[model samples]
Target: MLAPGIRVVRGPNWIWQNQDDGEGHVGTLCEIGRSGSTHSPEKTVVVNWDSGHRTNYRVGYQKQYDLIVVDNAQIGVKHPNIICDGCSKPGIAGIRFHCADCSNYDLCATCYGNDIHDLEHSFVRYQTANSVGVRVPPRQGALKIQLKGIFVGARVVRGPDWEWNNQDGGPNKTGRVMEIRGWDNESCR
Candidate 1:
């Protein structure tokens, strides 16, 4: 019942007789990874019953990614975080509560506690503002940075793993299009 591309381990070859209930020719087989990115991977094959032989199979190569999300301190969950949280820096690990509602920058602890941002830690902004193709809310998540705009088929960039480095965290950002609701304030739709 295996597919053409999938390879199984070739089992022992035994003579077929009306005596054995486990009828039909079978070879225990295991699959293997493919080769080049554009080429198919290699695999091992088991010869049919009554024969002891080895064969080769291949699986196509594919790209993979390791993605992870860092959590914020105060919120204790995954949210958009700024570099410094104003300036004082956050938690020792440098990972803390990040405002999900963000525009282009983040407010460090100093800025948040101070009257600089008007006591508001996070805020959102529209992509281009004026009338365009899509109808999105003027305000978005303050810490969130959406690229292509919100739609079924929008452009986006892909990245791998979570960069917890406050210094390098900025590079973790990707051009992703997200559907969000603004009336709820920090709520991500």
Candidate 2:
């Protein structure tokens, strides 16, 4: 589900029947209407457009989406002078992970989730953009093991353990691992 302060644009399925004037406009999600509520039975999102226009749009009403998420970052939280070391993004969004062992080293949620930094070192997870951060130590008794065969850019296919529906084309579909997250022993990607 989308949260407030996320940047969005008009979806591919946008139509003139939409409640607001969001055509060719970029906006930030201001509020989300509760599903099955008295006011809004269908899922809806209120947007504050960059052009100073504010309006509500349908999310999944009638199986059609009106808004597309451009950037999932929460812009309400500001962290001055902090830049992501992995992607070099000027402002880290969502949960900011700071390496406890490295000085002035930080990673955004995407980078942290993709294991961009040294996994041997511990990290402090910042719940918000400007939070003091909560220390997240490495798992106990877990040995540091290298990925035997899989590496970034390596093409991989769905294995037998795949449980989800065929969302990536089909069973024979292949995709590359953009980044590897967590320890190899932890069974995370």
Candidate 3:
């Protein structure tokens, strides 16, 4: 049932329900590590957590209690194309700043700066829909500056929603556009 790109719902581990050792933590199953030999029945399920921790559990062992594959449709995770709350533009990959208080209130980097949103409201800047590590925008505007070059060594910066790949080059790293490749996220690349 577990597969790559499939988000899993890790249920409460009964053994450690009372303890707070992060045993019942929820995360995505990243990989299925081999058990050395090809005939080996046991395998490791590598789970990458939202808290930035990677833990490996036995496949059969965890599946019985924790780790249920999440159906996006059943869980109401399916969004009908994210439109910028400020500009009303469809598929704005750069939409990063979000109002925690408001329901579904999101703003692109451009609009977040140009428009005067609630000054008292707190904002969380993220690169994608399923990114973790919420933090206030370091400053205003996009996470990275726009560049003209697309080739290697061309100084380019990441936008607010630049987490298309498993890559987060991080903020304020004035690095060149390493690659110009097609990404699955149409809004991003």
**Tens digits of per-residue lDDT for model 2 on 61-108?**
777788865444444443446799999987665567789999889987
Q: In model 1, which runs have C-alpha deviations exceeding 4 angstroms?
A: 1-75, 78-81, 88-103, 108-110, 118-189
Note the residue pairs that clash in candidate 3. Answer: none
Which has the greatest lDDT?
A: 2
lDDT of 3 by residue, 76-130 (tens): 2222366778888665453356777678877765676665476556687654456
Candidate 3 positional error at 178, Å: 23
Per-candidate TM vs. native? 0.16, 0.38, 0.32
Question: If the candidates were sorted by their TM-score against the true structure, best first, what order would they fall in?
Answer: 2, 3, 1
lDDT of each: 0.29, 0.66, 0.51
Global local distance difference test of model 3: 0.51
Candidate 3 deviant stretches above 4 angstroms: 12-25, 37-43, 62-64, 72-183, 186-189
Alpha-carbon RMSD to native, per candidate: 24.0, 16.1, 13.2
Where is model 2 more than 4 Å wrong at Cα? Answer: 17-24, 36-39, 75-189
> On residues 146-165, what C-alpha lDDT tens digit does candidate 1 reach at each position?
21222334443333334455
